[model samples]
Target: MPDECQPLHNINVGVLGHVDSGKTSLVAALSTKLSTAALDKHPQSKERGITLDLGFSSFTVPMPARLIAALPCRELQFTLVDCPGHASLIRTIIGGAQIIDMMLLVIDVTKGIQAQTAECLVVGEIATQHMVVVINKVDLLPAELRHKLVVKACKRLAQTFAATTFAGCPMVAVSAKPGGGDGPAPPAEGVPELIGELVKMVPAQPRLVRGPFLFSADHCFLVKGQGTVLTGTVLSGSAEVGGMVELPELRVVKKVKSMQVFRQPVSACRQGDRAGICVTQLDASTLERTLLCTPGSVPTFTSAIAAVEKVRFFSGTLPSKGRVHVSLGHCTLMAEVTYFGTPDGSGHEPAAALRLVLDRIGQLALNENVGEFDYSTDYAYQHELHGLEGRPSASGRQCQHYGPQWALLKFSQPVTAPKDALVIGSRFDTDVSKAACRLAFYGRLVALLRAEDPSELAHLRIFKLKMRAGSIDRVAPDGFSAVCKGMFKKDTDISLFAGMKVTTASGAVGTIEGSFGKSGKFKVAFPKGIVPAAPGHNSITLTFKRYIYDQNKRNMVQ
Candidate 1:
């Protein structure tokens, strides 16, 4: 059959469940390719009789001849990703979940829900909105008891996911393992029923053709003839043969030599389609799960400030100052959490605002003084006093610089993350005894702070002026000089001076910035100019940044 004539419906389905829950067995039954035999490819997995890594298999389920004539696609080709269920491999499961379109949650009918089963369900709920519950190994129970068990399992599932997005998903039962003492019994019960439920429940692939191309490579290897092959799903946009691609962090660009969708050669591939691409001018060894994007489409940043919400299953409160594992797509790294922002003034709420600073994990070398060059008027003389040999004749020499510290996090390496990206925060634990339930937190990247914008810090900063209400200040373009209403002793450190805020009787607000001089007078600068006030007549109030925890309100509920 020709390529166009063979209508293929490509969908990425992830098979997830607890250990020994027949996840691999279901994959084998569906594909008839014997995925368990491939488990021995890893010696440790073979010894333990468990899957230690992600297993891939594909199979085509033929559609009804009557339905095929009315649809654009003829067959459903599902690429099943069988993930490891061990507690130690939770990170691996997270990585797989990020790329899949829908999930097939397998559960052991005899055992119902186990420890890892609950963890995997939480992961799937966080990753995708579509899910199908598969209750496997029903052969262990009698036919009469099976219906009762199914009803009990459904109630338990509803209770577990009542607070989540996947509260009432569809459920089906099947026996993936071969039946005993049977000579080819006509396909154990619920086998065909499961397939029909899947066809009706699973949604069509999404089309993201306008935005820039974004692909996260989960696997990279060297093919015999092809130089480097990358296998992963397209997160957004589209890519075609001979198109230019770039790895923003690595700062390298390559050409797409060829493209394949589900092992079928194609001229182009769109969003939600699993693809394999062969690229030129790239060494296979240099690539390590890097994000591929169109040039100039993604922004690289060293630090960011965002808004985060904790997962419902996480029982404990997030630590103010500790390390947590942050996973964004396939990239997982350690991050520092800083609790910032004030709660509602109701005095009964806990802090809901937080800041996350990710640790750098790339290999890009940076200069020490990259962004340290001052752009002030006296920058030329200032650079000379520091024993600088060469200097640019111009004052603003386009060097990298860092701005004020207000809800800011700096990454040691360059990272590309757009606004509104889902950031999963998990407890960084290496102990095998601890369960996986303790490691699930979800947050959203709200905004990327730019160094050029100083006004961005205004909301997070607090100011308290030393001047009293009766002082009349002279305003100028450079700053305003005002006499201190309170007496200041000589030799007082300038650092003791606090920020100043003045509000006029007519309701005008302004902030003052500057240090105290030897004359006990202070000069303050305002971004929006100064508001005039009468001496000894205007009202002055001290301003400070309110801490969220100080409000004592409980805003977050588990």
Candidate 2:
């Protein structure tokens, strides 16, 4: 036999569904009943059908052989996560879904599939492929309708997810109601069969063969005895006790006090398994569901980016223009849409490239899949136009998908993560990148441009704007001279003597030439203005800072 039989221990399975979809009740019937004291609720979850946050509990599933020589393989320890089902808290659902090895998408047989079902399935397919769709509340379904709903649910799964890898998925019928004497008659004896299928279908956790470990936080909460604890599946590297973990955004590091996988304490946890890690030095409020990673191992990017490719925005009309919220991992920011489709205002759906000024940035990575915060109004607009809330028609707004395009996103704070993609969900068309060129453009970011080669940066162009720094000149004892080149003008040099003042049409005085540098032979200076001017040289060079601030203005007459 294959060594695949190494040791069957605990397999994490998360229950997902829409509100009132029976995820909690299903887990309740399967394991010992849950109590407010057992989970230590804050007077909200128990009364609310919407799981306030993440409800976690552990139980053993009878397996085939001895696992770890301690528990029987027939009995596998299952970490059941009952995630909140309300539409608004989908981020909470995503936080939990990314770490799960297998997902049990619970649906109400009476209600059939719902918007939440489609949403959860979309997230699940991105997070993991191993899924066993459970048609819950079968007990509530009339005998004549149960089978039909099961088939209908399967068809719905196939139709909604046809574009994804999980087109045709298997489903199990289960009732959370207790059996009078049979001790919870397997809601669907097929449930155990489905569990077996899960064992075979789900891929073993991927090994953390790299350096930077990516721990995507699914749940962050304060434990009664442990202070603050965060749980999630380590996406990439191995994390151990006594290991130091850094939060890129907060610029803080904490020691690992303990780590648990299946409620059993372990010294180290690897990729693929859901782990609950006890960390020190993090307050409950500060743990905003971000990653806990080893320093220098994960990808940390902070800089302005210049995306060479085109990108699209989807909110209102075809122009789809406006300020949208950008979310990656736990970070949220407002990014200016700039302009969509060719940047020149052509009606054609241009290649997927966009220029975004990241108004806010948190722990994020390059090539990471970022998404827009779908405001309730955005959904309401769809509901108003097409009567569809979550499923917006792509009629005229189909997102351009050219795979991952190069991008630059600037952040207000320093953010870190493994160099790998920091995905939010599986909306490929809605994601953007933080490429090397783009990062260097975001002002104040610590990340250096990969186009470190002066020639490379000089050639890196986004919408006809090339990356070029100005030549440095000691314009004065306390000031400096730098030049900026515009597409229409030759490189023009501007000299600032210490305390020398120059006023722009915007009425702001050029105070300090904060910094200066050169991309090729040209010099660049930071100035508080909106236009390019060489007062001396007829050809004017515009400072990038000035170039951006004045982009909306018409060129002045030399």
Candidate 3:
């Protein structure tokens, strides 16, 4: 398709890195048109000499053949979202990341990946699928050793991210501002090359244009007489002039008075497109960082179930029932987490069950097939999410797939979350001056518990594995009943174990009928024609599970 024959497609690219990494200058070098709030337009940002909020800018080009073949667009627009790199401003960076389709991880060549840079990298790994490593300030290196050092640095960074989603991603060396913006070098040395690389990486998948419209308003401001212009990306579905939308968080609903794509007035907007939505009867100041959507299309949840993975560089261990700040789209809220997963992945289940199933779920998670958790399946509780496994377990395990696969998050406050939104958990309480990663883990919200419907907890069934062993003392003449000893302590309440299932090592399965003689001995009743291989010679094992968060204490056997 030719450039003028089809509609324009927009791709949001977030420029993220540590403070003083030249991210704003890099965006300036790539953007042809700067939005009103772009490039440190904030007074405080200019005074502080660092990006304090997300800056928006863009440039256009002929749509690549890959995308043209996949959609009907003729022109491709690259919208650069310049995210603040300061550690304290991570919430802003996280919010910016959710609105992007790709990431440009800026690294100052003179200084390799710094503390905040690593945090941004983790955000990239969690929030987006595509990335490009921008090694900025290459001019700072000694001219004689620059080329060799760039190649060596690229190789080292590649190895560092080999186990991450960023493995083998494109690395572009650029001098966004040569001579540190003072010398007589060209404005940018390697920007066009970086753009070319990005062109080839545009996602070929079609954008969502049919669901209920959801718009994320990153920057909202009044326009003389027109209305409040919400400048952000269309997250899903489509919207047009005069369409009815709701600000669910504020309990306000309004109609779309008008819309624009980069100052070009348009009738509508679709998913993956960046635009300004004009709405009347609202104060922009009261609605900073808000979301507008078709009525009731987005849900506000007080708790959610999310699939989790450990941040490879996070030094702190995540404990069950621990509190962490969770970032979802435009907001960050504190949440208490409960961790659990299928028995096969973490080797936390009993050895008997582990031997029955040698699972490759970690391989699945590594390959990104670990979404849509199965609530019906059995799970084992963890005291805490352990670090990466150093060596294979006795079960001949695969490489370490750090962290559990699922977590139940009880938020401290209600949040509006769309389905499958990316969730990032961080310990922002950590000292900012430290070199450690405060991001504990990242994942997607697989399920939600609405604030109005507290009964939704029944759908999340994470449980704990329990096992007990005892010896069969004797069998009845009919070979159907046996007396089990040593199953519990002398003063134990054996009634709680009644009707639970147990199996003999010799292949006989039975149930604990009741306690016998008050010595913690129990009577096992096997089915007709079933018996232990030998009376007084066989051992019995009982296996069952108790749902981790259930208050009723119901026992279940598999």
Q: Which sequence of candidate numbers ranks them by TM-score, best first? A: 3, 1, 2
Q: Per-residue CA lDDT of candidate 1, range 1-558, in tens? A: 224623665567888999988887777667633232233246887788889877766676775454454445767667788889988788778878767777899998788778788788877866666788998888888878878987887787766555445656788888887563315533545767777776775564334467899887766777777768787778778888889988776778889989776567888776666777888657878775767788777677655554343444555456544567776666677765553322221212222222232112110111111122111111000100011122212222231111111123334455676444556667757455655475545545555654334454333332211233424345564433333323334454433334546554454455544445675444444455445556655444433333222222222111
lDDT of 2 by residue, 23-94 (tens): 776676555434222242536765663576766665655554423244323345566677777766666665
Better of 1 and 3 by TM-score: 3
lDDT of 2 at 378: 7
Task: Please write out the lDDT profile of model 3 over residues 17-96, one tens digit for every residue.
Answer: 99999999899889998887899999999888889888999999987766768866768889999999999999999898
Using all chains and alpha carbons, the TM-scores for the candidates as numbered come to 0.67, 0.57, 0.85
Count of steric clashes across candidates, in order: 14, 38, 0
lDDT leader: 3
> Which 10 consecutive positions of candidate 2 have the poorest summed lDDT?
378-387
Superposed by TM-score, candidate 3 places the C-alpha of residue 385 at a distance from the truth, in angstroms, of: 3.5
**Model 2 TM-score (2 dp):** 0.57
Cα-based lDDT at residue 543, candidate 2: 33
Tell me the whole-model lDDT of each prediction, alpha carbons only.
0.59, 0.48, 0.80
Where in model 3 is the C-alpha error above 4 Å? 1-6, 65-71, 181-186, 344-375, 386-404, 450-456, 469-496, 501-510, 525-541, 549-551, 554-558
Candidate ranking under lDDT, highest first, comes to: 3, 1, 2
